[model samples]
Target: MIIKKTKTILATTMTSAMLLPSAVLGKEDGRRVLEEVIVTAQKRAQSLQEIPMSVSAISGDMATDAAIVDTTDLVQYTPNVKFTAANPAYSSTSIRGFGTPPLAQNLEPSVGLVIDGVSYGRSTFTNDAVFDLERLEVLRGPQGTLFGKNTVAGVLNFTTAAPSFDLSGYINVAEESLDGKRYEAALGFPIIDDVLAARISWRKRDKSFGLYNTTRNNEEEQFKDESMRLKLDWFPFEGGEINLLAFKSDFESVGNGMQHSHITPSGFQVYREADPQTEDDEFNNTRATNAPTFTSRFSEAIALKMSVDTGDNWVFRNASLTAIASRAQVDTPYLLDSDFGPVNALSLETDGPDRYKQEQFELRYTADSDVLFGWGDSVDWVIGMFVGESHATVTQFARQNLTGLAQLAPLIAEGRGVPNAGAAEVAALNALIGAVPNGEQDVFAVNYVRVFAESYALFAQADWHLSSSLTTSLGIRLGKETKDGANGSFANTPVPALVAGQENFDNEGSKKEYEVSPKLAVSWSPSDELTVFGNIAKGFKSGGYSG
Candidate 1:
């Protein structure tokens, strides 16, 4: 009996492996060299030691060369993946801690992104634009019976650079004495010599930093980015094939707002100190600061692919993609202002100010080795279909200061809307804690994303020839999630809707969910370099709740 096994689940993306296949154990003189690394993770084409699972592949020239320019250098080469840039326009990622609360678009990200093959609703462009790849496949577990749900926590695929019938591409430069500079270029030949081929690329970078300014002068600010990509291929006759991809990017920055804790006076210590006005609350002094911030972003994407190769065995494929993204920010923060400088002053506030844009589309399909199985010759299976839509808009505003004007006399004779009292005195600073209103409400606007019903799944894997040195195989999947949403079309108002009969005001109109995902494997090759494996899986993420 031949059997291989593996178990993967680490919350998502390059985290433990999504779109996976990771196995690299070393020993040179002691003799041991393992390198199988091949996976579509069961969509066919196996050899990650014949599939047990836990995948991680990387190389966009080590993710944008010259000392790694993006994706936080891909979290130390993927191992439990976690990130918190919080600035440079916010960043959030986690795997194993199973996260979703990074710049919340109503919280939705357990990890499932695919670039190049297109499928990334929002990972803030996986740490904002910067990838020129040939590999980046991380697939962990729970893929909703073959990628139907939001992947519970797995999937991060990006496969670029494909256009070379015989012609190369490369150009790189670097600089970082603290003024970080980088430039990259690529080009591939053959336009129509053998049915057509093309490739084009470009990238740029600039960065500068130093925040606790000791006259490091440019004091925390500077990082510019630019990008471009293009690829095309057609073999017009050879069983048929076509591929096209595109990309664009622009990112700008001038940082600030990365400070945590220290408003002293509570048993304060910088080597001993208690009350006595505690030196007027000194934010742990570091040359105290104020004002200087800005962030901006713009992105683009396009993809098209077609496949057919009926020379025998079996094959067919289809893909379509699209994207347009936008982001904006404005910041002017200076904290610890216990009224004014002595220890905490310079308040020039601007916060969570917002602006975001989005556009997306998807269509996919693939099939190989149509199995009617005799249970030998290593059977295979794969199927697909998907669609998408999105939109977002947000706004924020704030202002207040008439020097508290004697605490506004009984909240202005109890005549105006109290609580941070307003009506001219610099105006409603806390509008009763919903925050000062300048009115332009339409936050979290996601008009629609209806796919209704078009989900079909069927998968199978077998290789029961487990003798001659073990090789067991297995696979299973079932799915459904026809999409639904309606919080009364967006907006559920009721400050006092039911009358005196309050019991949580029941009249429900939008809430329901269902899903099922499964997978299991076992493998043992034992020769041609050697092998062993293990895997167990289940992944699905689709539930709704937003207001």
Candidate 2:
């Protein structure tokens, strides 16, 4: 009876396997076969099953099939991963219940994002549209040894399709509801036959606003995006390869459909809820204003990687070295309705604009040798050093109107109908208005914040095989980070006495921190089909001031 049950289970599994796509499944002897997945979770190419860490890898084809254009779409398919977007320019990603809020420019992300082996310092850049990808690997846990600092949660690695020697190209077009349209295309060919190759890709997206504004008799939340990338590969000589990448992206959007839920006792209000599924046009409160809310972002990046082989030796056999350099810049300008009501209570805009720049350099060496006193067949190890610098400038301006203040003054005055109901009140209001040069809306506050950071790290990891069936790995990373910041605020009000402590102020500070992360893991494989693994690791994320 037990044998019959086992046979039934195996048959069911085989039937399910046959139903899967041929690209995801292998065929051998006219039978369905499970294919092995290759990954670089440990900074080296290896089979997914051979790695002892928990990881999820999604192929570009699978992403395209699912119509996944951004990081938020990945949450639906990945377990223990969550993505939240405060706006198109800011997002937070969490893995294993560890994450940070994307509220300020000075804050750092706990989860790290890596593209083509170069790490991104800011989470704002992670939500960009994805195109021409080879694979995306989500490594769950503290990947401090291989990825360095700010990887307390995990690491997301995106590998783009490489340039091919053969001519190849593809074009994809998609249309969706709300007049949304998307186009993507790629082309690859050889420039110097087997010595050099190039690939270029382009993507564009346009979508209509999903929310209707009854006050304005129009819509909000519309967006248009465009991006392009170029990649080049050169085999300058034997045992050496060089890769160069350049990318540029631009994103533009209209007002967000954020709505005001409640007003505080002091007439202060904030956005609390916005329901996109609601068909009622009046549900969203937006004022009809000549100044349309706008958000624009432009980003550009350049990266280079070179890999060379160093001749073999008794201690460092099969040695190879890799070097990487990358630089990126982002600029953004935003304007929004701060009150979220159908009245011109408060309007917020960037004082000037927001700007960010980052640069990084890394060098890594890897080898397979009997460095562990000839303990096993071979010892695989890697060592690397990284240096990075980032700078950010952000500013905001809030404008408040007398019309909005009058709407709230009545409620604050108890039985008073309006600010002009009595002669004394009218005179006081007139006096306040006269204090302003324009006798119109005044700048409530001007906030300016700047941040500068520099970081350096040394990391190493090694795997020692106790025997053919058992292996152990040890890794460590030592890092130091320093940050300098300035936050200043200037309040422009008609009546300064009424708003105490709202004067001009400036605060400057600096911080320096160091951390050491370590990891140990053991894996035992008694048979080819079964393996058991255990690991212990420590991780930490850097801290910074809130602007």
Candidate 3:
């Protein structure tokens, strides 16, 4: 009897433990009902089911559990979305098979990226690490109606956690076998009861060795990344609130992540003889290079947002006014090995500092009235205006190394009627040739480009509740964009005669374009559990210079 009682007790304990989570998850009669999600995909808070569009949302907890640290990691969970990146400066996001190539720096992105109501003008901004987020939202299809310009494909919206009156915090740490580690933490507290609050979050990551470099006896693709964010909320008066946000992010890499997957006969004979470890097998994680490469970016931004709720205004009831202003800057400095080999051949580096700066402001008004001039029982409408300016400067240099020139001395000598030179004589001649200025130019060419852009847009959207179960929405946007840019390539060879065939050009251009985008959508909900929606939208993108 004692043995039987012990067995029964063990079984009961195991069953209770297995069912505890389900019981706490709001199970009703053994049926688990999913929690409702609220989103701002249409510029207002509504249930995810009520949004008449294709949308996806990932909560902060889910993202943390899945180890999603950047925009690229979201592809696995979102359908018809893909991300491609050769480096931080060269990255692209495609939705529904529509995307712009990342090589065109001056061009606009087809997909828009917005964080806390500030839209990023460039796609490279997507490379920044994301942490302490409340939720991430992705809207597929054209979003030009309310999102303004350059949203030909879709939009990505990130909403960070706000300051709370309660004290809360969390720390997360992750480690791997390959010397990779990540640390993240966040804290929120009330500074002065319910009137003022603040929240801060940070993340740091580093990897010592992700790939081997046999020629230099070092590692490739080693990187360190860190990001910090601060948020403050102040309620100074009745029906008014202000939010201040500041953030900074930095990423540094020692070497570019690249390797040879195939080798030609001549390449194999040359590279293999120089370094026996050189192989075409990319999976081997080995590379041969004499030129050290590097890439780094530092970005920072600050935003101020204020909102006021107007009660029973003369022309509007239950109306709100919101305004936001933000400024941001990003600097990317990089070096590249042009030859990608053991030979001390050609290289490329930024000639000077590369900087991109932007500023933007937006003002919006939303009103929900019980009666809309007898048009419907209830109606909601939104109107907004946006203006922004951006400026960028980029300069680069292509350099030729002396050792690379020495390797070609013998061949040049042979062509110059000195074919009978022996091995010792050839070595002496090579050394003499490399020591001379005429052998190779230190600065082969310099590429310089500058771009400036200004834009203004006005947009409006309204939703009419025709009946208890039917609704319709119409949105339109009018935008004007202007761009001015200058680009030039100059040959700076020490001996101009040596590069007589080098091409050079200086060009300047400007463009002004106007766009009109509109959208129409309809939805019918017969019950709370089901909603059917359909929409058609148009998109546009302005023209710009690229090289």
Candidate 4:
């Protein structure tokens, strides 16, 4: 009997209005007011009401109240945002129907994720657990110029809380059904009063699997995760400050709860569904898989930021200069059942270790007078530069059972009615059967891939306050990237003909690409309660070789 079934998960995103202080309002009505939200969506600190863009900001308190632990949960509170996980190591995201599939390691994400002013290059980093955050900002639409490349859809920016001079600490613990438990703690204090401060935070989570494995007689997809962060702030001199952050995380899981549901034969429209009671069920109520799966990941990062304020003494009055440097590393390994059946047929394993580093600097000059650009204090601008590099190495191995293939070949031949099979065919079958020595199959294939990428950009954005009610903005970015890749694969088999064109394959390649993205926008505030804006922008994503 052949049966087919499909399953889907419904996702939702929400937006809530914030109440600002009543002092900003002209009249004191009984109506509840919304608080003013300040954000850096345009690379500067400004009131959300002043910026002419679609943005959603979530405070740390809100995230904690809702138990938002990861990007998947964070998206549910933002409008038009969705997150899908293909596995523990891969995830895809979309904003306003514009997104990229996490189909391959070399594929770049359409959305950009930035933390503490440092941009993350890979989608895998999006899965990092969230903790001790000051706020989270989701910027919709093409952030072409100021945000740089790979932001065709939108940007997710996270800002961690800064250290305070006053000593403070907090701890939280929670337990829920399904053996889920969480613990988090944070402490902040002054190292030197009014000059230096530090904050430290840690979190741990343990959860049981959501699915039951009948074959193993245990719950699958169990997980344990730990994360830590340290932050420091220094006020070296008047109008200057330095901030540093370091973070580390470790995650391990027994299984991902992926069940085999169906098998389809070649040239057949119908497929046979795995029996729910026989180790191939796909329902949430009952599930079964014969193979043991495991996954582990570890990551760490460090970043430094410095900002200096140059008073009206310079020609570029009220000037502020900023610089940032950061480095991060990630390592992951996993094993899965390739055949997904009670019968032993195949297994797959992969190990990957990746490193990423970046350096950035920016300088913004606000006119004290109409001396420099003749626009006076009505115009403000910023110029910046960025350089980043990433290297990744991945190894994969697969094992297949020759005995199973040998047992199925005769039936296939018989079903096809091939009388007096040729000697070559018989020899091939004998070779396959013979390769399974010592009651086990041989290694089917081993593959390796390494990629190194380097990228840099020069960008600038300027805003012109044409009048009290209107503003105009223009921005542009010039970026270039280069990548080098190396790949090789080897297959094991006794039959020389069967192994032909499958062993000792190696290749190396390189590519270089450049792009220019620009943006223009106009905003008008008709009243304190209403704002209108329109923008035209170009989006770009770099191209790279597939693994």
| TM-scores for all predictions | 0.30, 0.86, 0.86, 0.83
Q: In model 4, what lDDT does residue 524 have? A: 76
Give the Cα error of residue 195 in candidate 4, in Å: 1.2
Tens-digit lDDT track of model 4 for 28-60: 477755667788988888888777667888888
Model 1 clash tally, residue pairs: 33
User: Residue-wise lDDT of candidate 3 within 1-547, one digit each (tens)?
Assistant: 0000000000001111111110113466899765678788888788777777778877777778888777788666777888777777767888888888976655668888888778887777774536888877888888888997777788888788889999998999999556889999999999999799999999998987667888888877688999999999999999999999989998888887778877765466556655778778888777887788998888899999999998766656789999999999888788888878876657888777577889999999998766566765677789999999999877777776545644534444554656553344447545544656774435467777888989899999888787877788889999888888888777754422242344577888887778788888887777766677777787777766654
Q: Choose 3 or 4, whichever is better by TM-score.
A: 3
> Which pairs of residues clash in candidate 2, taking residues 3 or more apart in a chain or in different chains?
none
| Full-model lDDT, candidate 1 | 0.48
Residue 250 shift from truth in candidate 1, angstroms: 26
The candidate 2 region of ten consecutive residues with least summed lDDT is 1-10
List per-prediction Cα lDDT, in the order shown.
0.48, 0.74, 0.76, 0.70
Q: Candidate 2 lDDT, tens digit per residue, 1-547?
A: 0000000000000111111111377699999666777888888898765566667888888888988888888666777888887675666888878877766555667788888888887776775436888888888777777897777788888888889999998999999776899999999999999999999999998998566565556776689989999999999999999999989999999877554344443223211112222232345544233236888888889999999999796578889899999999888888887655555556778887688899999999998877467567667889999999999888878776654545544333534554443445445555666667785555477878888889999999888888887888899989888888888778776353343345577888887878688888776777665666666666767666555
Over the full model, what C-alpha lDDT does candidate 2 score relative to the true structure? 0.74
